[model samples]
Target: MTAMQRLAGFVLVLGFCIIFLFKDGRSQGNLLTGKTVYVWDFATRDGEVNSLTGNFTEEFEEALIQTQQCIVIERRKHQRLFEQRQNEKGIMSLDEISNAEKESLKSLHTNIVVFGDIYDDTEAGQLRIGISVQSFEGEILTKTSVLMPRGKKLDAESRQMAMKELVQKLVSGKDPRPSSEPIVVEVENVRFELKSCKLSGGNLVCTVVITNQGEDRELHIYLPNTRIIDSDAEEYLVKAATIGASAGSAKLVSGVPVKAILTFGTVA
Candidate 1:
């Protein structure tokens, strides 16, 4: 065979190899990356009410306080309930909650809801979080959450950090007080394509087209970068994509298609 033919053959075989080996991994990672995470927010329904005096004797005041207490208590209960559900039934979203309870919870808060999931991965060595936020009217608010993972070998602190970040993202909006960071994930560009792929000399290259994607998560996209792809790409691929890094996640802003490039190749 001619050298040109050999080169072509080599290229084809190398391309196939790179794609074959990493294709599934890439697909899985991207699938997870492009996931329409149903960030399940704990439903909220209660008129905002605060009293420094703790004075409440009217029936309406009693009911309001009871309603607020129920909201907080229910959150605790949900912690256990959702934990159990996750163990036995898999991750639970607020949407999975019974309709009756949904209505009841809806009556508690007209402005906020909480929902999310924590994913553990040993390969990426980090925790992945996906959250869904919805309004009291049952409309999806935001289906984004930050990922937190144990950066190193399994240790108590790493595990604790993961859980802490997970919880922070899950319930960051609940607190009226300001937080160092917010919980929100925005996909600026979601692209998909199949093209020449190869792994040579320790470098892998696969060109990818940037698709229109991203959420205007103002302060919330600062959560640790989740391992969407285990490749030779820099972490900034995800971080630098944003205009600026804020300390927290963004609020749910919808109706806008995340700017995405329809196609692109992978290079490593």
Candidate 2:
């Protein structure tokens, strides 16, 4: 049976839930830039893997290797690592990544991640392929979408052309934080703006900005109750927190914004 077929059966046995591990990795045209990348199996909109998606993903990885720019992690060789995140869809936005899964990726020693989907194109004889590339720091560096001949499956030359554009983009493009979309929360005028959440020195550090709109009432930030929650519904209690020169229990004034760094212990 094909990899897709086996994965389909495996997914069915697990109630059809598809999960993945993602971390930082990267590009093309250079002789093995020593950057690590992982290409996931492409899937249909309904989350089913098919020959078209499978072939395209495999071909793209081969193309990337040919350019001698990246070390593509063969998924078959790391099946257990891919199985680490056991209850997530195979494809999702970068923001949905959880802390535990990020830790898994770190363990995998990856630097770049590539995933894509196949959609019906506007034209009659083509399929729309949308691919996204993300860095280890949870940033979506760039994305590309192209139409391929329907049922033809791209030949070696066409696949090379496709990966060449993406590799060039990665090589030339500076990784950007497309995933950091201003995660803001408010509770009775205490606006908390999460600037970024990332792994640093084996701990999860989340930088947040707190705005006190309490009209000059001393904004009380009770550090003992703060927690860093992940997309997986798992909560990591803040082991250390700080604001400016203060290490813990920092207060804010009305209309003044104070930056707080909340640190959590390693999820592993």
Candidate 3:
């Protein structure tokens, strides 16, 4: 064989070997090596845990572990590390950790941080737990919430089921529910006059009148994250609904008002 043919054969073999190595490395990397997730102890909005908060955290960690997709840093471990860091910094209490410090902690070599709060819904006789998973940079990746109905006692089974659902949704990256929080922006000379808001069969129906108090101007309303807080301070997530008037494309003349009906769903 000619020297050129031998050289071409060697080059072809080298290219095939390189491609094989690259493909193998990519497959190995894609395997479930377990993402490092840290679960912070959930705070209770109504005073203390009352035992439910602690158990919920454990269940959350267990769910992640069972998925074989996460290496969970349990609450106890996280507490110890937090305390150690506080001691090193001469901080006396966990409350002393500023928001910036907390954000820094969440970003510390962790792939995901799961944190949230539990609220006692006194009127409904239930416990509302809101869980959010965030990236190291503090961007929320997914949020799932659950409500455990309380009869005469705390329903442990219901809580477990909620945790399982949350974990499954988190792993699957599907959120059927809308956001619980609202994105509020202040527009000069434009005001929202809430007409009426009522909860009817697990949904909150609300009507608001938007007025252009200053000058004639075109206005757009995008309220994907809009929420309604009841008299009891319970908040519901707003669902997408058609407003009778085109709120998103309303051209309001001076002193004119546009009435829009808004609907929100109860977060479970």
Candidate 4:
């Protein structure tokens, strides 16, 4: 065989080896796997209603177990480990849980932690529970909320339904919060200003100022109805809008300006 033919054969073999290694590395890097989850006790809004949170946590753990999507760590084992750390470090509260302590807990091979707050919605005559699930790296994976009829007697069936919904939402990777960020859209007789913007998790959050120049009138702005147009004529839909803590709708009165935070989820 000619020397050129041998050179060509060597190059072909080298190319095959490189391609095989690249494909192998890509597959190993992108493997999707189940995570080990640790569910902690939920805290009450008033800090006085312990039983409410306890019951909710119990139901939540049970629902998570039934999903068979995660390896749920036992509450007792988690409590013992937490208490051992607290005693050793003189930590008083989980809020005071340091990065070192977090790393130590990660050593247990638990990848996800779920915890939340239970609020007494007295006005609505219901109990509002807000739950957040985070990764061991402290990144919030999802937030969930459940409302149950408030009464002297706890509703077991309602609690079960709520827990099941939360678990299903988590496993499905759906966020209850609005997914779109707010951007200033140019409208006739209206002035739109962007004050600040930030990327939080998978959402773009922005603080904006809106001013109406016309006569005394009420201007209703639906954030989700708004669209962001790029230089390339690509339109991005706004998923959610909020003013202060209140979300969904915002009212702009004539001669009165309003500043509100808007969140937009990244285009999937």
Candidate 5:
């Protein structure tokens, strides 16, 4: 069939797909992979930078490097340059910098900036530190935090655990979200409710619940016409089928529900 036909067709006699139903058209790569990150020294509740502030910046950057996903931009050199320019312009922070200054800083390989804030919860006897990840385009991607005893910074193991949580949050934020409502397709008086699509034993398996909405009928299904097309336009044809109600037969009774599994062995 033509590309146009495939573009509009996910209806297989027993074939359907999970195309872009769960995606938002963004790059589907792991969140931090190759992303340029710039982490700042955390500001304490007193509005001052202390040793704890420096440790937050260093440890967080180290954790990001260990993942080997993002490109951690060295802040020292770029920060010195930024300071020198800011001094000459009599400005202090990013908020005071002009649009021209932001544009000029594009030479630095950077995508997101991490700003951290630490609060001393004396009553709770805990130190709460949160980091906000913001795109250079001014979008807040995520806000994550960890709490430790009020004494000082996190212990080695605690630091690792906290960093892992931060990484998990970043990765999950970029993943495709499930539909808010059920996805249903109707064809020839039959309704197909797409339950889920998953991979098993190296094959793509799509689970569907099929129901006859009209009178009992002969549902002639040409297997070759059934396939799964992904958002990348890659196609996987139906290789095997297991229909729970009729033992793979196509006869359908009105209002009868049948659960079926369509396997696409062409998956790689």
Candidate 6:
């Protein structure tokens, strides 16, 4: 080949090599993997450091998080309303029922959503966390906004507690309620015994034994006020019994050992 042709070939190869190298670098620094993003602060002449709490930084982040959370809450409330419509079916207004009854129904149907708005103060030393909950319908339930003294924090855990409190308050129809401590219930050797029986009267005396298998856990046991769900006559006899004219008797047998004996007779 001629020298001039050889030189031209070398130049072309070099150009291609440079182009390939540039492309590889471009791919590595692509936004998908994350690249340094800079925002021009019109307030600060040319640009400002992208540090939390500067002026644009914390506000921008807080706005983004709030918008995202609002969208999520809106969607959740829509879905919950759909579910409530399905569950209510033919039922219209619950006005006729007792207030207690209406509350019980509401508890079964209502839905709550919790979220957090996180940002930093101007100094960027304190992180601000706003724990809040909303009804599916965009109504604010409970909000506890506090500035946590931390550089960064994950709001998930705090948000969860905030939600739990909100739900409990909403369900109870109370505001400014006391915070709830963690509660766990463990039932061990729960057994039933028949004390007495009268076939014709359909009355049987029965006792329920519930032993605290593990650590102490506060419990509220609802005796069979109505017929036990999906229970046969024999099973119901142990759980429910009617003595004479009285409907039933329930005894709270728990201070430490945690044992309860309920006896009642059912009229046949």
Model 3: C-alpha RMSD to truth?
Answer: 21.5
lDDT of 6 by residue, 1-268 (tens): 3555334323322232233223322222111111111111111111122322233223332333332322212222234333533222121112212355334334544343333334456576765534333333333333344444453334445434433443333233333211242112222422222221112222332232334344433333334322221111213323433222233322223343322333333311
Q: Output the TM-score of candidate 6.
A: 0.20
Question: What is the number of backbone collisions in each predicted candidate, taken in the order shown?
Answer: 57, 7, 0, 7, 0, 9
lDDT for model 6, please: 0.31
Query: Which residue pairs show backbone clashes in model 2?
Result: 24-110, 24-111, 24-112, 24-136, 25-111, 25-112, 32-68
Provide the lDDT at 3 for model 1: 49
lDDT of 5 by residue, 109-143 (tens): 67876766677888999877676565665433444
Worst 10 residues of 6 by lDDT: 31-40
Candidate 1 wrongly placed segments (more than 4 Å)? 1-74, 77-88, 91-94, 150-268
Measured over all alpha carbons after superposition, the RMSD of each candidate to the real structure, in angstroms, is 19.1, 15.7, 21.5, 20.2, 17.1, 31.2
Candidate 5 global lDDT: 0.60
**Residue 92, model 2: Cα distance from true site in angstroms:** 2.7
- Give the better candidate number (1 or 4) by lDDT: 4
Off by over 4 Å in 2: 1-33, 83-89, 93-104, 122-124, 154-160, 177-194, 197-254, 258-268
Worst 10 residues of 5 by lDDT: 84-93
- The local distance difference test score of each candidate is 0.31, 0.57, 0.53, 0.56, 0.60, 0.31
Error of 3 at 16 (Å): 50
Among all candidates shown, the one with the greatest lDDT: 5
Candidate 6 total steric clashes: 9
Error of 2 at 217 (Å): 16
Tens digit per residue, CA lDDT, model 1, 25-112: 3211111111122223321112112231111112112232232222332333344333433323322334345665555554544344
